[model samples]
Target: MSAGSPVNLVVLVEERSADEALRALLPKITPGVAFRIAPFDGKEDLLRKLPHRFREYTYYWRAVNSRVVVLVDRDDDDCLELKAQLSRMAKEAGLPAEAVLFRIVIEELEAWFLGDVPAVHAAYPRVSLDLVKRVKFREPEDVPGGAWEALEHLFQQHGYHKKGLAKMIAARDIAPHMDVENNRSQSFQVFRDGLRRLVSEEN
Candidate 1:
């Protein structure tokens, strides 16, 4: 979506955690570029409603001067297939390929927290930086079994409450401190690059 007004970025995410994380990350990367989040109830709900959302966006594409970015978790699905499905939905909605972008976090959003260990340590100082520095995390977008569990495990090792893995607080805390340019997660890099491309084109 692109109207004659300044560029507006509409990002659709899986839930509150993603929205919280983006709130922390977007300003640093796209200052002066307006952005908003449309978060659904978890991944399943997002996937179920996404095609309809894309169709809805087509109606305002020109009027709003907005661009749609769809972000999802790669939870158990084939990444390429999921992307292709989203692309198909966009085309079906009569949106030009360039009008919308789709990105998936491999295992889960927690992987992004792992991408910048320092940010994680900063968010929850109780979690020792030394431990974070020593333990290796899998790729951000595609963890094998349980990304949140892995994160919780790491926290446990470092002395955070056994059951108090606060997702939103952690995202809010870590995002502000993350080095968007040097994140260790490939998926995170791709996400940032996509936003940069959109912002550059708008400029």
Candidate 2:
């Protein structure tokens, strides 16, 4: 949704790729709710600005009936501690906990795409459908090196994104084919659940 359009939710993501992915995913899960995405340059940028943004969102809530969702990547950090920090930032900004949902993508947004292998295959027909059956790919969030690295490898092996994984293009192409109910990443499921809960509460 456009910034001026009535929005039920405003998602704060760390990059354009995530914003692109959710642009496709949110409509499937959040029926009847209009939403907007605000993408920062990177994780550090988002973390640095969240307090001020949260404070603005507190005002936005009353003015536009919009709630907020803050999505970040866990990377190598401890998940629980990171989540607590986000909650603390919101609290400090005087943004009510109930008015915001903070979700961490266990490694990165690429992990969500890895969680739904069939969606990848749908977007890039050259990718192997048997990827889900592989032992290493069984748990997407647990992949060793890093989620994006793994995705880059896969795309290269399939002759797609040969030079590098074009994150925005990948997200835009794959997200539309994702099966929200079938995604295997626990983090993705948590994200979906939290978003649904937020929508349900308001609706």
Best by lDDT: 2
Residue runs of model 1 more than 4 Å from their true location after superposition: 1-4, 131-135, 138-145
The reply for model 2, stretches above 4 Å from the true place, is 1-7
Measured with C-alpha atoms, the lDDT of residue 4 in candidate 1 is 50
How many residue pairs in model 2 have overlapping backbones? 0
lDDT of each: 0.80, 0.89
- The digit string of per-residue lDDT tens for model 1 on 37-125 reads 99899888987898788888888877777789999988779999999988988998898777788998876778888888778878778
Q: Global CA lDDT of candidate 2, please?
A: 0.89
Q: Which candidate is the best by TM-score?
A: 2
| Total backbone collisions, model 1 | 8
